[model samples]
Target: MTGSRGPAAASAWIPLVVTVTLVQAVLALMSRALPLFGMPLTASSGMPPEAVGQLSSATSLGSMLFFLWGPALLVRLPSIRQLQLGCAVSAAAMLFCAAGRWEGLLIAAFGIGLGYGPSTPAGSDLLMRVTPKHLRATVFSIKQAGVPLGGLAAGLLLPAVAAFFGGVDAALVTAAVLALVAAAALGFWKGTVDDARPAASAASPFRHLLLAPVRLIGLLVHAPRLRLITAAGFCLGVAQGVLMGFFPVFLSDHAGWSLTAAGAAFAVLQGLGVGGRVVMGWMSDRLGDPVRALSGICLASGLTMALLASIGPGSSPLWVIVLSSLAGLTVVSWNGVFLTGLAEAAPEGRVGEITAGGTFVLFSGYVVCPLLMQAVIAATGGYAIGLILAGLAPAIAGLALMIGAGRRQR
Candidate 1:
């Protein structure tokens, strides 16, 4: 009912998809680069390394705040406008976060987070509105690849740029400019795919905004499938957050690898993720049930986490690279399929709402994982505890998804 159907639908969605993907990539580059971006501050200003956490957590907090109200914004505004607003905010926030010090850093990080808040719900709304159902999984997966690609650029490209132009300032400025360009491109889209609004509902706009939060909470509480899937999101988030946040350090400190080797391993992991998203998403598309495919990926992800836990200093570097890269493919990949399945699970016209709710839980993992990892490490007196926990979480998530998918089959 929302997207154009047949031949027009396929062609129409491409430009929006490219726009949304670029926006996601730039935002991701900005956020993913934060810890890396802050290192110079730690070195020069003697800012505590802990300060990076504040910035990172602030971004998560900002995202949560957006999830609280972002769905409601889509209820009235077109997804493109919401997306453009997000881009503007992200561009400014990237610049602010890069330049600001101390309190400024925290505030800017929060702003960056806030800027990210609308992207998933708005992008999901836009994609689902315009994308034909048959192509949704593959196309969305391809779009989702932007996540890893942005990260790749951050890990690979930004460092190269920083070496000459120097530091995060130049890189952050580049991200900001791209964010503005993404916004400008969207402004020129001129499509009506989801631009039309229904006649004024019985409820006033103010009322819709006021109660949207309540509705979202209630939906999470009552929607059994969604609740299960979101819980899985939490599990996946914990594993992902820990994997990304700590893998490099683990390799350098614990595994006795050189910094360059650790970085290359991280790059391999991310590169695999970029390809895996599309491949898994395509498989999901063909399956006619993305959740089933997602379950298998989660299951594989758990297995890979278990493999990582077994990797120790005694292991060969070649063995480490192979296992670690596989871990990347399984753990870091699969978001596209997962999110596509989440949107598909929702009732029509409600993808935005579902995505917002789901993304909040996903981000909650980001907020909680650091503390959780520390606790697990302290309790067990080892990092192995963290890896085991990550392994178990995704395995449980896989089982939950398997059950959910089975029930749907019935």
Candidate 2:
């Protein structure tokens, strides 16, 4: 993508990593910007919370759609262009969000999600190709750290920008400028960091779209191991979705913590996740078997979820923070390791396709789990009931991964 036709030089990793990490951070910021940016956008535009939900749904659906077809587009476009395109889409989304009414925000959110869709998989495709095998997990984890760092940035920067600009316009513009700068930088670089495959041959786009579903179904039906692993990833997604959606509320509502305190706790959880991803990733590499190591981590994090569920309002505040930290470390840290594990297990040369498929299933959790958690909470009228169920997700995932690893060993 950057270079002519050659693979990226090893020394190019520094800028490449920085650029991709920034991409991740930007997308992460967008994903988390709802309360920060979303609130202001809604207020200024006179949109209701229900409208915001529709906007969020649009984003997630856009992401899922891209995850399904992103790699195909990747093949058709230069990786550099792909990276820049993702940023551009997000830029457009942010601009629309800052100015557009509810309808505009809904469309903008979809653009944002679709734009972010190709980033990780494309980045992963590059990392797996460029980095040495031993370093993949650590390096990927470093890239993955962008998510938490992005969250941290949104927390620290967006508010000040909004306050400074006296509106969300200046903040969104700043975000857009950052993405454009990154995209421009990659364009100027002479290295070929992303030119992995030849452009898609002259073929009808519809033919490509028509065949995607058939090929996807075939990929799973023909590969039982991949299917099981994908299913397990879906479970991880459920655990991730539930906790991400519910943790702050649970802290405030059930644990009787103030909103500020709960938000602070959530920030700490995100901070911990930044370190947790690296630690878990390094451990997976050191153990030399990501699947088994991830299994253990999943089990450990699941226990922390259970611990959180057991902590009622009368429980010590410090203990809740402690358990939250544990969950943050174990549950939130799994993505890099999980991505590495999925890559390791993919059929040779099929990593990109598998990554797309796995991501689709993973995102399904984001769509399904929170709704399920909400229903469970509503039915039981207790946070613990839903949380206990959330706790089971990772445990189930660990079991599935452990069994899969054992079968591979045999």
Candidate 3:
């Protein structure tokens, strides 16, 4: 089922909320850990800082591959089982990463990302069954807020742990322990949460794999709402990719901010993003239309990015903080609203599969847009042109959605 309108007892969906939220947090911690600990991690691993980014790229590639093929696995494994497996894989990846060898880090990064692949589709599958339609955006946003919280933990806790415990290995081990404990804890909730099983398929896994891309394309082609939202998601991903992936670097290298100052600005952006998700969720619920909420978000995000791209050495620090806060409020906060709309648009019995397909497109933006941005930067010898293009993508998408909504109303 997509969603229902009646009020639901908290008991019916609260457990699902907790389960999915915890899973999101774990995934965020694992992925964000690499960037936060990059200096020490690269130094200890005997890899250059630039080379460490390749590991992150590897992780994204792994996630995209799994998302493409996830529906096949969903036919056999319940969402709860998927979550458990994701956590377990992440735990193992962390341990492997602790080896501090280049080859090991490459494998571990990809493994952790593969583990993260199921997070949205699986979580949405579980939540949509129990969560009321009225409360859908709020609930999903609450779960997604765990991402910013996990990132906050990475920024605040990991550095301290590394400092007190003597190095990067201790921090890696600490993250691994958390993943294992989360996996074990999930086992208790399995029977209760895995109430809905995916319909079984007669096709072999190989056959299913072969058909995955075709199936996803067919879904998008048939579902107009899903296609629109998926495209918007890709555009939004470009802005988000630029901000989260390169914001600090931009502030330090282009804007002439100190490393500590740049890091503080980043924290402001991420910290405010937690509250932003919740607020955006409430707005979406009140508006009774996730699309409108997302349109506004994209517009705001584009505005913020444009403003940020204009900042340079002589710009005021207060202005930088303001822009960062706005970026956090819009760019990072759009995910929950976007995901809720995607879940609502999903056809019956195919929420997980459709979500996997949509996310695959969205993840493609994260992987591809930055490369384009780099090319723009190389050609222009300045950051402004690239950032402007990033902002323009979402602006155009938001305007298109708004116009489309208007025509439909007419």
User: Residue 153: error of model 2 in Å?
Assistant: 1.9
For this target, which candidate reaches the highest TM-score against the unseen true structure? 3
Estimate, for each residue in 259-309, the C-alpha lDDT of model 1 and write its tens digit.
446666776777778888888888988888776776787788888877888
Instruction: Give model 1's TM-score versus the native structure.
Output: 0.87
Q: Cα deviation of 404 in candidate 3 (Å)?
A: 1.3
Q: TM-score for every candidate vs. truth?
A: 0.87, 0.84, 0.89
Q: Between prediction 2 and prediction 3, which has the larger lDDT?
A: 3
- Model 2 has an lDDT value of 0.70
Backbone clash count, each prediction separately: 0, 4, 0
Q: Judge candidate 2 at residue 299 and give its lDDT.
A: 83
On lDDT, the leading prediction is 3
Query: What range of 10 consecutive residues in model 3 has the weakest lDDT sum?
Result: 1-10
Q: Can you rank all candidates by TM-score, best first?
A: 3, 1, 2
Per-residue lDDT over 1-410 for candidate 2, one digit per residue giving the tens place of the 0 to 100 score: 22223354566766677778877888877766654454445656785322333455566778888878777656767566777888888877776765467777777777877887877677777777667678878878878888776766665666567667765667667777776776677676434655445456366877877677566657855776567666766776667766765665566567777644665676777778888888988988899876677678768867877777887889887887787677778777878876786777777656767777777778777766666666677678777877778778878778878887787889
Shift of residue 231 alpha carbon in model 1, Å:
2.0
Error of 1 at 226 (Å): 1.9
lDDT of 1: 0.74
